[model samples]
Target: MKINEYNVVAIEYSLKDANTNEQLDTNVGGKPLEFITGMGQIIKGLEAEILKMTVGDKADVMVAPADGYGEYNDQAVQVLPKEQFAGIDLVQGMTLYGTSEEGDTVQVTVTNFDDNEVTIDYNHPMAGKTLMFTVSILDAREATDQEMATGVVGGVASGGCCGGGSCGSSGGHSHGHSHGEGECCGGENHKHGGQGHGGCGCH
Candidate 1:
């Protein structure tokens, strides 16, 4: 059946920067990325197009910045006192995690720094970039009430690649689904389908 709201969907996908054709992330030969449909578990653009596909289908989907991580905001860039980042060796372009004002985990990149001040970009690393997703649908089915309620596939927790808060990374890159800010899907402690927040860079 075509994917619909709360349907558990699994797919193997490879993401690339549309402009530069730089491969960002992929799960082609690994665990399939699974998420609930119409629940904001994944990027808006990707979900919209995935709705048009069915199991066993493959296609390329392009997502604009607005539908992906959102446009890069100048206001998201801030210069804070270097003292705030004490105890860590700061490197340019390195991503750092911190709690936001709302107590959510926020990922920021070290853009520049000096002895007194540090410049960080709160915008997601993929912000303002169009993404290309080569996707192959592996499975799609209606979610049970429990699964829908918990946003967990099969309504049971397991330690899959990107499951249960472990973002299964390669070279420090995560290929899990991304939503609000840096929220990641399939986190066991937090409800999935946009209810919880975690760390993952793939969008």
Candidate 2:
């Protein structure tokens, strides 16, 4: 079937940072990545490119930050009192996984910390970068009833970004389907879909 809206697509892909040439994530020899097309289960740029492809097709697509994970939000960075993180040792470049005020599974980095205050950045770790994807479409098929209703193929789940034991994650690299407000954790089904805020990067 053509890979249109509501179709389930399976693909093998490798994601990399365009500038650094560092491989961010890949699902090549493992299980092929799968998601419902037009459901926001993947990033906008990648999905748009996939929309133009068919089964067994191969392509290399470059995604801008705005259409990929998304541009970094300066306002999302906040400087607050350190008391908010009592008992935890504060350090620069530390990623913390915890629940937000809305009780969502989230990861934030410790940008700076002082005796009186701390700076937290809620932007996606890969927020502002051009993403390069080498992808091959394996198959495309109709979505099942359950997948259509929940908007995900797998059951809802969560993980941490760095080392958030509170999130019950061994390491913080894995993520789930809910990224607070915006962004879908697309790769390997580890993160959330960016339905509200536009799709962002996934692990």
Candidate 3:
């Protein structure tokens, strides 16, 4: 089936930083990632790639910073008073969540610390890096009524991917779940199965 709006698709992917050629994410030994298309569930570049695919098709895609996470912004870094982290053990190289000006939840990394200053970087880890994606379309089909209602494709009837008696991974890991019979996160479909390279890091 051709991947289109509301169609379910399943794909295996390997993601890397184009410039550094560093592996960023992959589907090896992991569940296939699912989502709804044209619904803003996946990254724009990936969505665009899916639109050009057919069932059983495979392609290697290179996404620029603009199409991926955009260039890093130095202004995103903020230095806060160390006292703000009082009561929590502070450590370097730790990741923390913070609110952006637009009130969106953002991930920040602790870069440095002094007697009173805590330096945090708000840029996304992938920001400024070009992305390389190798993807194979495994399955693509129409969404079932149940799947559409629940807004997901692969799990129990509760419509949630995790957080219930539904199928879940060990160690708090989870793949996308379906709410309806044919409903998936996007118009893709498939389960992940393969060997882990280093460890199951979900990437």
Candidate 4:
């Protein structure tokens, strides 16, 4: 059937950085990436293209940074004095959680460091980079009543593709109770996933 909202579609895709050709994510030899269409379960740019594809279709799609993750925010980067970091051992490429201005937890990545200061960036890891994907739809079908009701894509019975319960993974958002097969936060509002990669299990 043609892909549509509330439909489940499985795709075998390899995601890469458009500039550096770095593989960012993939689900080909493993559980094929699946989501419910019409739902914002993935990047907006990719979702728009998936809407027009049919099963067995193949395409190499590119998404701008704004449409994929987003542009890096300079304001999000803060170089704090060495004194700001205490107790924790600092590393060059480690991710650490910090409380935001509003008391929300934000993940910060250690980007650079000096003797008296450390630079951490709170931007989404993929921010500022274009994404490219080689995709082939493996399967597509209408979602089940329960699946649609729950807004979940690959559940236990579907041999869950994204093993992580949190789709937010390394993104700026949190999965709540979701793994990589992200659902709406708390699975309450599956309509919008979040900032960049949003949605429930709607492929």
Per-model RMSD to reference: 6.7, 6.7, 10.3, 7.3
- In the predicted model 1, the residue pairs found to clash are none
36-150: candidate 4 lDDT, tens digit per residue: 7766667678777878888889999998966765677776666777766655576676655544444344445678888898887766566677888888888899888877776
Say which candidate scores most in lDDT.
Answer: 1
Q: Where does candidate 4 stray beyond 4 Å?
A: 79-90, 97-106, 113-118, 154-180, 183-203
The better candidate by TM-score, 2 or 4, is 2
Ranking by TM-score: 1, 2, 3, 4
Return the lDDT, model 2, position 62: 94
lDDT of 2 by residue, 96-124 (tens): 66545444455566788889987877666
Point out the worst 10-residue segment of candidate 1 by lDDT: 186-195
Q: Give the TM-scores of the predictions, in the order they appear.
A: 0.76, 0.71, 0.69, 0.68
**Which candidate's TM-score is highest?**
1
Model 4 poorest 10 in a row by lDDT: 194-203
* Model 2 CA RMSD to the hidden true structure, in angstroms: 6.7
Residue-by-residue lDDT tens digits, candidate 3, 119-174: 87655556677788888888887867766666566435333121111122122222
In model 4, the Cα lDDT at residue 11 comes to 84
lDDT of 1 by residue, 83-136 (tens): 766666777777665444444555566789899987877666677789888988
Candidates sorted on lDDT, descending: 1, 2, 4, 3
lDDT of 3 at 38: 62
lDDT for 182 (candidate 3): 22
Stretches of model 1 off by over 4 angstroms after superposition: 154-203
